[model samples]
Target: MTNTFSPLATYDRDAVRHWTYGTASTQVPIPPPTGSPYLSDLSFVSGANGWGPVERDSSNGEQAAGDGQPITIRGTAYTKGLGVHAAADVAFYLGGNCTRLTATVGIDDEVAPYGSVTFALVADGRTLTTTPVLTGDSTAVPLDVDVSGVQDLHLVVQDGGDGNAHDHADWADARLTCAQ
Candidate 1:
């Protein structure tokens, strides 16, 4: 579908914000002019990850972007999804044309038995759904959030209380159902 998004006052496509934990900073890329049901097909408006850059269809690895393995949570592998580190917020402009957002979120198996994180789905500025603290050993949390009339959607992953050491998170098979 065509992207009908016009930049809101809060969203600056060229702005960059630095993180407190480390030297890593958020890089805001220009949002795609077109939209797709699959989130991986659309570019993020703004976001940052603790480790490497946010990867598409793969898990966050120790090296560079797109160097991650298949997105796996609790032994289940996903072919399509987003791989991000904790303290990450990936946003997409919906233009109030989307109906729903669905995904199975969890810590990637790459850091199994280790990392901890929390997943939250935000529509516009309000939180729609949030998962409990999820560890590498925890099962994937399924999310189906109503996003109708929402202009922006954010997939946020935060470090669970402790520090963000091994917090590799995944949004498996993430898909958005939008109006045609």
Candidate 2:
């Protein structure tokens, strides 16, 4: 006599699993900025928040979503940007309407002397630009990438081989130059 078990019997259909990498888990529709091409104003196709929800035009804080302070990096305050934590990904669908993307990337000062992370810009599944390992002591790095004819854009932040502790990251003054 032999006994066999079906894989379907062990599967939990109602269980919800959370993903921290690869694809995003949240999606939101953003209103366009008036007379400006800031990425913060564009709708995000998908997003994954590492710790707290990504903050718009503010620094990643320990508080609830949208409850962050002004985006600050190296003591410099920015009026426009996206505040996210490490192991985060924010994707936007450009539909080939954008030409260039620019931003000042850095580890938010809120976690100074604590967190470390790396920032990357991926266009249509290809890495257009990436930054070196950035720490709280590092100054903000400027990024300028050409996204000509690209349909998808992903702004990613990864923990620098270290645990995601206080890994607050910021994309300051992020903007996209696109056709009107």
Candidate 3:
């Protein structure tokens, strides 16, 4: 058997870090900033929460299905996104000083109606990268943002004003790198 569980990234002097939300079993509550309402079916978990990459039209309580392990680096399977619910947020910290952050954002291959969600990276109240709209797993949104002298970052995925309908998002190959 393979050890599918691992941290988002393995740290080193180069000050590299990664974020794979569902790799571990830590469940953190994600409340909206202030006026935004809470999105449903979003949380942290390990493995495929028995969800494939398809979102249903009706509200049968099946939001977390389409997300599972994504491509892995080295030998570790990547973690799922933080939402079974439409919108999800995760707190990120870098182990070492870094100048840039990069990642690929998309809805899991197991989910459907991908156009109903949008993934973004928000840092210090600025929207760094926001995908127009995802329709399927065929495409992954690539985001590279300048994080020089920055401390905190927020990974967010939101329902596209469609009331969280079939919104299963994922952030893959998330990495923080320093200027070399």
What's the distance in Å from true for residue 54, model 1? 0.4
Clashing pairs in 1: none
Best by lDDT: 1
How many residue pairs collide in each prediction? 0, 0, 13
Model 2 per-residue lDDT tens digits across residues 1-180: 123433322333459554332332343434332234777777677888898888889988975988788999988999999999989999987777778888999988888978999999998899988899999999999998898888888999999988899899999999988777
User: In model 2, what are the clashing residue pairs, if there are any?
Assistant: none
How well does candidate 3 match the true structure in TM-score terms?
A: 0.52
Q: List per-prediction Cα lDDT, in the order shown.
A: 0.85, 0.84, 0.49
State the lDDT at 126 in candidate 1: 94
Better of 1 and 3 by lDDT: 1
Model 3, position 120: C-alpha lDDT score: 73
Candidate 1 local distance difference test against the native: 0.85
Give the lDDT ranking, best first: 1, 2, 3
> What does candidate 1 score on TM?
0.80
For model 1, how does the per-residue alpha-carbon lDDT over 54-96 read when each residue is reduced to its tens digit? 9999999975977999999999999999999998999888877
